[model samples]
Target: MNQQRIDGGARRAVFAPVDNRARVDAVVRRIGDAIELGLLGDGEQLPGESELAGQLGVSTVTLREALMALRQQGLVTTRRGRGGGSFVSLPEVPGEERLKARLRGWSTEELRDLGDHWAALSGAAARLAAERTEPEDLVQLRRTAAELAQADEAAACSRLYGRFHVELAAAAQSARLTREQVALQTEVGALLCLVLGDGEYREEVSERLRFVISAVQDGAHESAREPAERCVRESTARLIALRLTL
Candidate 1:
């Protein structure tokens, strides 16, 4: 597969038009989440201003504002002259201390609620994927699972973990669901590093993802849903446990 097309579904979702009300902020978030999800490669040149603005269905002014914010945050960089354009600058994962502090801000009830919502979204996506997807359509999910298994760093594992669910939503062929998954992942993705950083848990997550893939491939919608929900619930439970410790 071409590197540019490795996560084509996600790449499309990232660049798709933004919600009208939050154009600038929405543009910034969509691209930023894609970077964290590894859907957009570091140093990748983004489309030209006019082209990107058109693709996003936003005015050039809005796009420029969004790009300016991204540059200030170090998530994007710009150069002048020929061949000059915005390029991705992948943000480093938050340090463990910072992640923990952020987690501490969430109450147990909030975490549980988020977990329930996450499980519902993932389960629905998995069931739909099983019914709607063909074997070839599962390539991205399988690749993300494989990468998650091999990832040694917490940040890499967490991003790949979230990417799997995003790809799962894409496999369902629902653009809305895929976008929702992307947004949800950004909400909890970095926090996942706390639990996924454990080598044993990482392997377990890798296996769970494979099971979800197999069930989807076999067209067992309920089977696929079960493991998909389980994965989210398990991660949420672990996070809750860690949260209690704080």
Candidate 2:
């Protein structure tokens, strides 16, 4: 296995074209989410402006604008003169208090609805992966689950947790599903740190993630869906509970 091939699905997604309706924001989000999820490494150089614009089906002007926005957000850094280009700069995860304050802005109903959508996407991805993917194709999924289990902090755990589902969708071989999972994670993945921060619950979710992987590898599509959905539902329930305390 080529080491670089790991999580390639997400890398492909990060540079894929934007929705066009909001091209600048879309580019910022696609790249930003990839950085936050660790799909792109710190200090990794991005494609040149012209090449990147071509890859993303955007104009050079649009790409430059988006890059400027990323620079302002501290997600990207640019160098001048020879060998100059945009580089990834991973942002630090918010402190617990900041995370709580962010979570407080979401109503319980909103969290529930987002969870439902998340469950649907994850369940469908799991089922498709079981039916469509080879066991060997699941190495990335297994690797992500293992990483999640060993992750020492809430931020690391949340990134690996979200990465697992994204890889699951990738294993399903549905580019659209993969992209949807990426976009969805940018919205909810960080908030996951709030619940996954608990050691006990994190361990439980890790086990559930392993079960999801096992079912997919075993070709048990139906069995794969339940654990995936349950994991999301449990996490969402935890978040909602925490929100009430705020």
Best by lDDT: 1
RMSD of model 2 against the true structure: 13.2
Clashing pairs in 2: none
Which segments of candidate 2 are over 4 A away from where they belong? 1-94
**For residues 94-186, could you state the per-residue lDDT of candidate 2 as single tens digits?**
556646655765789989999999999999999999999886878898888888889989988988988998998999899999999988888
Please give, for residues 1-246, the per-residue lDDT of candidate 1 as tens digits: 786795788788888876544778778767765665567898999999999999989899999999997887677999999988899986575557646755775789989998999999999999999999997898998999998888999998988998999999999999999999988989889789889889999999999999999989999887889989998999999999999999
Model 2: lDDT to the true structure = 0.85
TM-score of each: 0.64, 0.64
Candidate 1 residue 84 Cα shift, in angstroms, is: 27
- Count of backbone clashes for each model? 0, 0
At residue 181, give the lDDT of candidate 1.
Answer: 91
